[model samples]
Target: MVKTPLFKSLPSRDRTAAKKLVAPAVIGIWIVILFPLLYALYVSFHDWILSQGKIGEVNFSNYITVLKDPLLLNAAKNTILLTVSVVVLEIAIGFGLALLLNNKRIRLRNLYLFILLVPMLMPPITVGLIWRLLLHPDLGIINYMLSLVGLPQPIWLADPVLAMITIIIVDVWHETSFIILVLLAGLTSLPDEMYEAAMIDGASAWQKFKFVTLPLMAPTILVATIIRMIAALKTYDLVYILTRGGPGISTETISYYIYKVFFVFLDMGKSSAMAFILLAIIILMTLILMRVMRTAEQ
Candidate 1:
């Protein structure tokens, strides 16, 4: 028999094969994600006005301009309002609905869940377009119905205040399903023995949920909230398709403003800077949430 090696060479060969298998994905990520990010960061430091041919001029003046812009400030404020409102409403409404659906006694629960999830399944653009048609001030079925009922048919996306509220409602409608699905899965995965013990202890329905369920489910809720908040901070497509930051910019978000700066205003440098700023904000939120999650887990 041949002398056996102390460490197998096959393991090294396997590692090589595994690296070969993962190489494409790594390369693709570099090309698709890392390269663009690096290029964008480089661009942020230079003035690159497409229209005026002011390319490759290094400066941080645009970043200062962006920081001081009142419109950007307004967009930031609007984003905060929209993010907070939608997250709160969606979490409250979604968790409530999840609790209802999680109950075995609810009739046609599957059907209801399917219907409720329809909006979320639709693309954001499609949702925006559908709601636009439905909420059209003059020609929409909603306004027509309101007229029949002798009520004021407000312009959903035209009025400044209403535009913001409409965006929030539309966002809630589209996003609540996600919250419900996450929370419902969390509810389902919880151990039944704990609840059985609680029942043995003479805990009421509300008491069981408050004392046992909430503590166990807190982490899941925090995770879902963080994911939603990150997405919320990056809101652009809905605002784009729905309002285009119009009706006097009441619904303008930082993402939308950055788009306008890059594409509409032809200011690539400032847009890149704004994008990084937004990234920093997102990273901050993520870091804070991650810390909270770790603490909660412990």
Candidate 2:
């Protein structure tokens, strides 16, 4: 005898009831998320202006203009650099902290964990403001410490390269706590039998981490990396508050550039096109990462 499919096996009345239960959520999602996204896609194809309340001819010209813009190009480059730098540093530092905290002999581990999480708890804008004050050139504590150590004070948010570095450092400091929390949870959930077995087989610490811990932690690492990458790609608050995309627009990210185009330049069409492009890039990256993770799992 052939078996019935799961959905087919359900009673028609039950199926109808389930659909009724799910209808509100589906409708809400379409109204709140899908409708705006579809509207944005529509707006992206036109030459739109906010003050005049006019949407000019519908065409691909907006996309073409955005793609050819020098500011967009620069912002794209800076965004990629920032995302890569922050994600890598955060992973390394967070993993190290997690390993330290995972130690059975560590005292006051909870207190240390709480302290480490303080940065992540603060609002992004607040963190940016605090770091801005801390990194102030002449009167800031950072420069004062440098002076005390016989080091010349360099303008952090003024120079292009240093500005980028400063942003990256601030981002890492603020976001690394998330990675540490995720990795620590993953480490805690891992079974101990594998480590015991490795120890029985005379595996060294590094060998155990390499052969045992990493394999189990791969999914967690991928998840943390993806989360951090998405956040880094859309970084605007920190850049806005810390540097305002100044120092010759050296630290301007894609999101910040989009904001400038929409508000500062008041170019709605181009900004919408750029926003769609950014969304596409993010979706593509997320898909690639998910595929890689699935392949690793397999």
Candidate 3:
């Protein structure tokens, strides 16, 4: 039976109307999200007071001053350190856990997954406060346990290096579950025929994993890592609550530094400039990830 012209063409008008209705929603979304970002960029180039009438002129002075500021540079460096350390550790542990849990023998898999996801679901401020209590030199559980073992407890928060280390540890703890869940999904969805073929070809377990598993799982791993990096780089709540960017700027990551500039110092211009710099860095990294992974997939 041949379809009538009315039947074929009736949907076109509906789709056009739907697109027209969606246009305003799309524009509103752009306005809400992109407007603030573009405004922040504009503020970064002008020396604008938070309470001023208008930002008179735009210049690169804010960027220049921020770049020349040693404290800002140190904060950027520390932020990079925090992001890299957390991502590396989380990926390793997350993948390891995923591989282990992927086994058929693990009982209560759903329960384990639920427990692991608790940290990621918790509020950042709560995690910070909880870790602060745990890392407390005098009354914390960690120190108390160490004392029971007849060891002298070190000041975890007071010491700069220890403080940074603690932040990284907490970050890894919180985010590894996300990686685990994504990887577990990827692992379970994998075609078993590849592994079976490898076994038929007399390939060892390690070789099958190294060649077949890794390549297929690369896309999932890349997505997880990118997400984790983005979250880690923007980490502010944990550092803020735990150290307050204290111990003499030792654990001062970029987000916390921006908070300090905007709130503590009331330097919106400098803060905006620093924010734009961070935005540029993240955007570049995302683009690079896309290119490398696209090529790899091909």
Candidate 4:
């Protein structure tokens, strides 16, 4: 039995050179990504940075304090509300839009897609500013339109309930395009024969959709949900721009709360703890989503 010439010709020096070339790049990436996470973890267990600055002592007091803080609890509630509401709305709207556009009969599909995706592609700051202007009570376009229609103008950002609604609207508007793109990909990838067979069997539109479209698109939908959930959970830029976590903290999410703790309040220890806690929640949710998706796939 003769070994391959390629294997026989391979030299120890080549392997040594390849290792030396790759090692530094791998270490550089680890330092860039892992180092901040490690430092944040270390800081999360410390007491407030005292007069000694970097010489401060370490403890679990910060985590304990945050766990007991009423503000943190409220922030947690608001975060969950914002994430779930926006994600659900985005998925529904996105699915509807994807289904509509998937039909070849729809005229100017490219134009429709472009229009739908513009909001998602806009800069977060720009989106926030545009929404702020539109939602403004006194001199905004929305109010003006309402007045023209003999309706009372609603204070979109000033009331707590309205503020939450405004946040969800903005999130859904920006994120629905992503869902549409993902689902549309799935729709286009499906085998048309299944739908043809369903049609031949005299299946109703609803029945075909329920029995054929959904099962085939389940994996794509799961992936899109995960992506949207992660983005919604970490939503910060639009919230910061539109509300600044304002209207009496009604829109204050965990990310915004963490920002306030670290930057506005200058409490690094507790902020680090909160950040780690949020990280843990995100990890758990991602794992759950992955497991459910795998089950569905099988």
lDDT of each: 0.91, 0.93, 0.88, 0.87
Query: What digit string (tens of lDDT, one per residue) describes model 4 on residues 104-193?
Result: 999999899889987777887888898889878887899999999999898888888888889888888777888998899899999999
| Positional deviation of residue 157's Cα in model 1 after best superposition, in angstroms | 1.5
lDDT of 1 by residue, 1-298 (tens): 7986765556978889989999999999999999999999888989898898857788868778888989889989998898889999999999999999989899999999888887877899999998999998888999999999999988788789999999999999899999999999999999999999999999999999899989998998998999999999999989999999989888899999999989998988999999998898889988998999998899
Candidate 3 minimal-lDDT segment of 10 residues: 3-12
Error of 2 at 63 (Å): 1.3
Candidate 2: global Cα-lDDT? Answer: 0.93
Clashes of each: 0, 0, 0, 0
Q: Model 2, poorest ten-residue lDDT window?
A: 3-12
Runs in model 2 lying further than 4 Å from the true structure = 1-9
Which one is best on lDDT? 2
Candidate 3 residue lDDT tens string, 1-298: 8965655555878989979999998999889988888888888888866665577577778888888989888888998899999999999999998998888889987788788878988888898899989988878999999999999899998999988999899888888888999999999999999999999999998998999999999999999988888888788998889899879999998889989988887777889999987877888878888888899899
True-structure Cα RMSD, model 2:
3.3
TM-score of each: 0.93, 0.93, 0.91, 0.91
* Model 3 misplacement above 4 A: 1-12, 51-57
Question: Mind giving the per-residue lDDT tens digits that candidate 2 earns over 1-298?
Answer: 7986677578889989999999999999999999998998898898877877788888788888889999999999999999999999999999999999999899999999999998998898999989889889877899999999999999888999999999999999999999999999999999999999999999999999999999999999999999999888899999999998979889999999999989988878888899998998899989999999999999
Deviating ranges (above 4 Å) for candidate 1: 1-10
